[model samples]
Target: MCVYLLRGIAFSKDDSIPKTGKAAIENKLLAEAVLESIIGKKGVSPGARLSLAERLSQLMKENKVEKDATKTDNQDEANDVSLGDKLAKEN
Candidate 1:
């Protein structure tokens, strides 16, 4: 997930975070990086890793950052209806 780090933010399917040694984590990207770091580490407890997503979400809320913007209207619109359903309705 560190590979997907955008401007210091990184994420992955497993969830993790990156370390900012000697530096203050001030950017929203840090949340992503943090997730990446968690994914890279070994032997992380299930409860601890599960907390990562919630923690990142809290941080984003505190910073007034909206992640919903990552999704586009067009993308969701396409999924609004199944192809078979649409075709049946059209017929």
Candidate 2:
């Protein structure tokens, strides 16, 4: 039964990630580096690693865009309520 169960699962020829240390981590996307760190010490299928990296990259991009939008909105709000602008308008 155990043999049958193991046979049912597909394994990759090279499930491990290559490269390590700061050199391997540097000059790469944050998501890739982070996953590489995990796969270096632990085991992860190549397909699953790729999928996780894709999702993590997407989330990071979305978070950056959201932060930029919020910053611009806050600046606009500050300008709208500025004391100088209000006093100038009244004068």
Candidate 3:
């Protein structure tokens, strides 16, 4: 069942589980294409396509939130100074 759903999404590749930035970007593009393809593909139930699209949308939202949090953490770290640095600056 899982295999069928994945195939419906896109053609299987050895690097399906992307491990790098480029691969992740490619996978996302592929997913967008799949969503577009499914809408016109015949024989697929509307419910299935809607469910898949909704899940993808949800995942994208979650990913954005996580990225935002990471960016905020990085900004906070950048604005922080070590005690030694503070002391050196005051000296």
lDDT on C-alpha atoms for all candidate structures: 0.54, 0.49, 0.55
Which 10-residue window in model 1 sums to the lowest lDDT? 1-10
- Runs of candidate 3 exceeding 4 Å displacement: 1-43, 72-91
Full-model lDDT, candidate 1: 0.54
Give per-model TM-scores.
Answer: 0.25, 0.34, 0.36
Better of 1 and 3 by lDDT: 3
The TM-score obtained by model 3 is 0.36
Q: Write the residue-wise lDDT of candidate 2 on 1-91 in tens digits.
A: 0010111222234644333323332434774555455443363545555545575688889999998776754667756777887899999
Give candidate 1 misplaced runs (Cα > 4 Å). 1-43, 65-91
The Cα error of candidate 1 at residue 85, in Å, is 52
Residue-level error in angstroms, candidate 1, position 16:
21
Q: Global lDDT for candidate 3?
A: 0.55
User: Lowest-lDDT window of 10 residues in candidate 2?
Assistant: 1-10
**Candidate 2, pairs of clashing residues:** none
Better of 1 and 3 by TM-score: 3
| Residue pairs in clash, model 3 | none
RMSD of each: 12.4, 14.0, 9.9
